[model samples]
Target: MSTLTRARRKLRAHPVAADAALAAGVLACMVAGSFAEPHGPEGIDWGVRTPDVLSLVLMTLAAAALAFRRRAPRTVLAVASGASVVESVTGDPRAPVAMCAVIALYTVAATTDRPTTWRIGLLTTTVLTGASMAAGPLPWYAQENLAIFAWTGIGATAGDAVRSRRAFVQAIRERAERAERTREEEARRRVAEERLRIARDLHDVVAHHIALVNVQAGVAAHVMDKRPDQAKEALAHVREASRSALGELRATVGLLRQSGDPEAPTEPAPGLDRLDELAGTFRSAGLPVEVARGDEGAGLPAAVDLAAYRIVQEALTNVRKHAGADARAEVSVVRVGPRIEITVLDDGAGQDQDHAPGGGHGLLGMRERVTALGGTLTTGPRYGGGFRVHAILPVTTRTSGARDGRP
Candidate 1:
């Protein structure tokens, strides 16, 4: 960097040393000004008369006090003003000790509030100007007395302006930083939500088709030698289930492809219209699912349709996996006013239906889907025998404004 820039950075880093250097500079100026005579035959004359020993001593004390201006501004101003007053009363031509007081006043104003700056600035101006006017050998109306008042006023005003500019810049910096943090937080939240949506889709597809494949494979193994024809049919069913699983998995994973990748599947998501086909797959897997529709062909929102379809799919998968072989599940979809209701009931009487083979996230996933679309789900064991899954969804999805329109 440039030499001037490096010096400024060092001054800011070591303020005590910078203050001592400033005091030396101010002392030099004061000693030089002491011998100058403004009223000489020439416009002004330097080294016309030397200052007394007492005036030199007072000027030294005032400059020394200024070295501590930043640490104790009020105390420095008091000391500098007192020295200036002593020089004003006794010296024939007063030394410029009051220059130190002006610098001290500026420091105080820049570090303090406006009210405190005004009070201290006015007090320093009155004391120094009044001392020069009332007791100096020069007349009360001399220009030197008035000059002290004008310089002190300028110093205070300039300092207050600097403080205001610094504060404004600081406020703008803080606001920009807060905005950046908020944007990062929002992006993270969207990533988390998208991950959850993809997880649910994968689980529903894998669970439904894999369960069928497992059942058909077992049947094929059991009948391999005794019943060759039945075994062949079972193997065929396994191939069909695996094929379906692959198609669904491909479609689900396609969603993660970037814009530059090959185009993804555009097929509409499954809904109530696919109920018959869904039942046929389960029937072939040895679970009898009976579907009933009571709503006279009314349209449903895309989110609601997908949620309804998944809920039925998950509930039936659970029945086939946990319920006894003979268990029969009944699924019903009915539209009532502004809402559509779906119910799945199974009379399974199987082992503890509360827990599935590998820990059950099926119920939890279903609940999250329903809740996202502002719907409600109730699932538990029926009183007499099996399990029941009931869900009520608004025909027109009423998602919270915060949702990212995942469906």
Candidate 2:
């Protein structure tokens, strides 16, 4: 940086030193100006003409008071004004002793509010001008009295302008900082939402297929010795379930890969269009799931379709895991007015094992999905002897794309 720029930064960093330097500069200027002759051989001469000892003393005291202007601006202004009044009355040769008072008034104006600046500025101008006119050796129309009025007014105006510019710059800086913080908070919120979405997708994919695999594996083991042929078919079903699970898992994990990696699977997300396939897998596991639809061929939004399919899938998985071996599940999809309703009922023998560990999380995830689309889901044990899951989803949901399905 330039030398001037570095010096300015240093002065700003050390305010007390900056103030002391200002006081010394002002004192030097006042002392030099004090010797200029008020009237000499030439018209308005500028030659040195020393004032009385008292005038010199008052000028020194006024300049010294400016050193602490920022610490006590009002007090410094008062001291400087008092010294100028004394010099105006006593000095035979008036020596610009009021210059220090002008500097003091500027300091007070910059530090105080505008109302206070006006009050002090007017008071200083009136008292100094009145004293110089009434009691000094010069007449009322003397140029020195006019100079005091002009200088004090300039000081107040310049100082007030400086204060306004500083306040404006500070406000701009605070606004920029607030905007940066808001952007950071918004970014964090979006990342958290994405993480939750990935987690829900993983759970739905794993839980549905894993439950079927568990069932088929059990069946294969039970009939392995007595009926080898039946055992072979059950093992085949287990293999198919596992393969489907792996495919879905790969698709889900593919979403996490970097953009430069291999392309993600082109297969579409599972929706109500895959209802038959989902039901067939459960039937293969010997759950005897029956599906009935009355959606009237109405197109559903992408989010609603996906959410409806996952809800049914998770409900059926719960049935297979908790319901007794003789359980029979019935799934229904219906359209009523502007809403699509889904219900899954099971005629399983009621058992305490229905409420399994981590079971609440599955229901909670389902509820989150439905609620996001402004829908509702209700799942609980039926009055007689089984579990029931009922969901009401809006047919005309606000989605980013149109999904081909009758939810």
Candidate 3:
């Protein structure tokens, strides 16, 4: 930082020292004013001789001490006030001794709490004004004595005002800074959530399609020469897998774009209505797929349907990968009054079902998708002997306004 800025910062950090310097300057001016010839007021020319060197020296010392008034406010006030009283009672009362005392009072008021300032300030003003009037052989209402009273009051009032304004400004700045931090933190949290949802979706989509490709490639390799036609069909399955992978990959990646970007894709997401096409893909793979429908199809929102389809698809893919070839899986969809229920079951001995329910990514992704849309999912071994994936999705979607449009 520049030298000027550094200096200002240092002074602000030590406001007491700054106030003391100001008080010292004002005291110096008052001392100079005291040197002016005292015009005999009201023709009372009985001034024997002006205050000698001794009284002047005392006034100067007291004024000089005012420079540290804010640093040690009580000490400065006590010392300056005592010096003023001594000047009034012992030395010449005409000297400018009260100047340092007035400055010290103001500093005390500004640095300390207001109640303390008021009590101390009022006592100091009364003492200075009363001593000046009574010790000078003048009436209590003399102009000089009243001027001390007014100056003391002004000093206390002005100091309090300065302190209050500084406090108010500091409070406003703190509140604004806190609000800015909250906004930044909230934005970061939203970004992190979006990234997680996108990652989950990618995991589910890729795992399903990639697993299928792996299966087809293995079959094709095993039958390349003896079953040339079967190899061609396996290659076709590979093509289908690659295409589906591309489409789902696009859907997952599309979430990365800014919501308002012109390049962003505008497309309808998969929903429950598309479950038929999904089932057909499984049927083509020789898995006997059965589907059930409900009359209130229009009630299901797009997001709910998509989550439902993903749940069923993920479950079926796991069955194909893990279940024995003879296993016949039953996939059922039912709609109750307020919910759509999905269940995937296999008659095979599903001791492995203990682990199938662990989505690692697929089941996890399914749960996140379902809950994001205010739904619930459960997966475990069915009673008597098979693996089961069941999910309950609400007809009314949860609009959480999160990134990736999870809701």
The model with the greatest TM-score is: 2
lDDT for each candidate structure: 0.89, 0.86, 0.75
Across residues 1-407, which tens digit of lDDT does each residue of candidate 2 receive? 99999999999999889988987887788777777775777755554566678877887898789889899988998998898888888866356778878888888888888898999889988998889889888888988888888998998888888888888899999999999999999999989988898899889989999898888899999999999999999999989989999999999889889999999887788889999999999999999999999985778877888999999999998888888889999999999998999999998875533367646767878988989888998888888898989999987765533333434
Give per-residue CA lDDT, model 1, range 236-296, as digits (tens). 9999999988988888898999999999988778988898899999999999989999975
Runs with alpha carbons beyond 4 Å of true place in candidate 2: 38-44, 129-141, 350-355, 399-407
Residue range 232-292, candidate 3, lDDT tens digits: 8988988898898898787667767686755644566776677788777666565667776
Using lDDT, give the best candidate's number.
1
- TM-scores, all models, native as reference: 0.89, 0.90, 0.83
| Ten residues in sequence with the least summed lDDT for candidate 1 | 398-407
Cα error of candidate 3 at position 251, Å:
3.1
Ten residues in sequence with the least summed lDDT for candidate 3: 42-51
RMSD of each: 3.1, 3.3, 4.5
Ranking by TM-score: 2, 1, 3
Candidate 1 at 229: error in angstroms? 2.8
Cα deviation of 127, candidate 3, in Å? 3.5
